[model samples]
Target: MAAVLEPLPQPDPPGAKTSASTDASHASGSGLKPIKRLISDSRIERIVPESNAATHLQYCSQFARDFIRADYNFCAAKVTVARGGKIRALDAAFRESGEWLGKALTWIEQHPTRSFPLEHEVIELKITHPLAGRLVRCLTQYDRIFVRSMEVLLAGKIQSHERETLLLNAGKRLKHIVQVCIPDNDAYLTDGTRKTK
Candidate 1:
């Protein structure tokens, strides 16, 4: 699914003490909407056989990769547009990006493998899946990047050079993640036998 790009409530004005009502409004704003599931149980059952743990892992990884890609693209577009002397707009985009990043991390943490039945049988599959682990770490890094960026933006001390640098770093990271997630890439995949490196 595409990342939600609804308008988020503006942050409190500079030098203004944030009030309780403002905080409540922000909580109920579009920036903090409920997270959508990355993969549904019914979809998993339809696409992956119960006995095929490897395929399930592959499906989960692909879904996560797609979601992150879409989110990154959305954030990039917002940042690009906001670079045209729109600081408040940029701040809103960063806040929205942070929300999506949190959702992605949560989804990764609650990977389907962790909830699969026959724990003993799938324990190794859950622990040993390189793509799943790598995706989690990558998303964590992204979360950190966005949090730091938002801090700078919210503090009203972000310089143009600093914003450019952050965007460059984020783009580089996104490229690395996309490379790692390529389904046919031998670096992250194996022969059709479900062998993991």
Candidate 2:
């Protein structure tokens, strides 16, 4: 005759708290009330608008220059690859250009104006500014072009003529960006006197 074995203990049902467990939780201070966190107000009470504007303008100008350089390098790489140049050269060019693009994109993403339906007046001001918006748009377009160039370069399936067309389009965009950033010196006189055409 074999002795009968006892059934194994089952886990407690969900939401069913035992007295020992509850006592242990209280002992561990888990039952204490949560402390209130100090939250700062969203108002821009202390910030100077003029200083902020100047800083943003300076940032936009610098970013525009960097973006132009990156685009130029990437386009150069594309052109080189398209002209039956070495892949090694294209790889080096792409690596440098990619670094610049990455930094620009990160800055754009972190900017307060990046959020939609601007709740703050300061953000609205930046987003509406001509230079700020223009730079953002140019950088965004450049990002798309960069992706396409990478795909074409890696796949190596596109014809040489097709690559040339892509390069031409990129060059046109780059030219437009450059013209916007750097106005014609002849158009603006250095002195107060107007230049006689």
Candidate 3:
């Protein structure tokens, strides 16, 4: 005879630390308002300003490098996936005096023919953390394209040329990503009106 599978019973909730009446009194005493956590889905959110995108790319790259050095799986994966494959390892970024922006800026200024190598280190690292691999893959294409586009835009800007085209292209790219990643009802107005879905 074959045995049938059975579901396990749910456990009872832990006893309350405070009574409902006490909660209300506590809330009233100091005008304590319940805080709703702002759960933003970055995956869907469009890059606002080009500057914002740059900031994110730079910081995410820096974090990835530090995380790799720390040997922390969680942080490393978050950083690597967040960047996609557009960036090099964090160790490379901190070559001189352990400075991130300094090294990056210097590299940019010097305009090295080969700034950084694109190694699939993250993919191997992802073996220990599959989610990190996914994140890395997502960010790589976007980051690379965004960075290249930004460079062209900056060159135009520095040359005192009209940046309308550059701005438009960046906006378009950001919009495309945002549309894919963000749901319609994510944003809201100050007056508590939810954005149209």
lDDT of 2 by residue, 1-197 (tens): 11111233368999986787664554324232221211111112222222223112111222223443343223322222221222222333344444554553443334232222211101111221323343444445454443344345445545557645654554455454433223233443443122357
TM-score of 1: 0.34
Q: What is the per-residue lDDT of model 3 for residues 39-103, given as tens digits with 9 covering 90 to 100? A: 22232132221121111122123223332333223333233333322122222222221232233
State the displacement of the C-alpha of residue 173, model 2, in Å, after optimal TM-score superposition: 1.8
Which residue runs of candidate 3 sit more than 4 Å off their true CA positions?
A: 1-72, 75-124, 157-197
Q: Rate the local accuracy (lDDT) of all candidates.
A: 0.37, 0.35, 0.31
Best first by lDDT, ranked: 1, 2, 3
Task: Rank the models by TM-score, top first.
Answer: 1, 2, 3
Q: How many backbone clashes does candidate 2 have?
A: 0
Worst 10 residues of 3 by lDDT: 50-59
Question: Which of 1 and 3 is the better model by lDDT?
Answer: 1
Q: How well does model 1 score by local distance difference test? A: 0.37
Worst 10 residues of 1 by lDDT: 118-127
lDDT tens readout by residue for model 1, 93-156: 3444455555544533432321222111001111123233434345445644444444454555
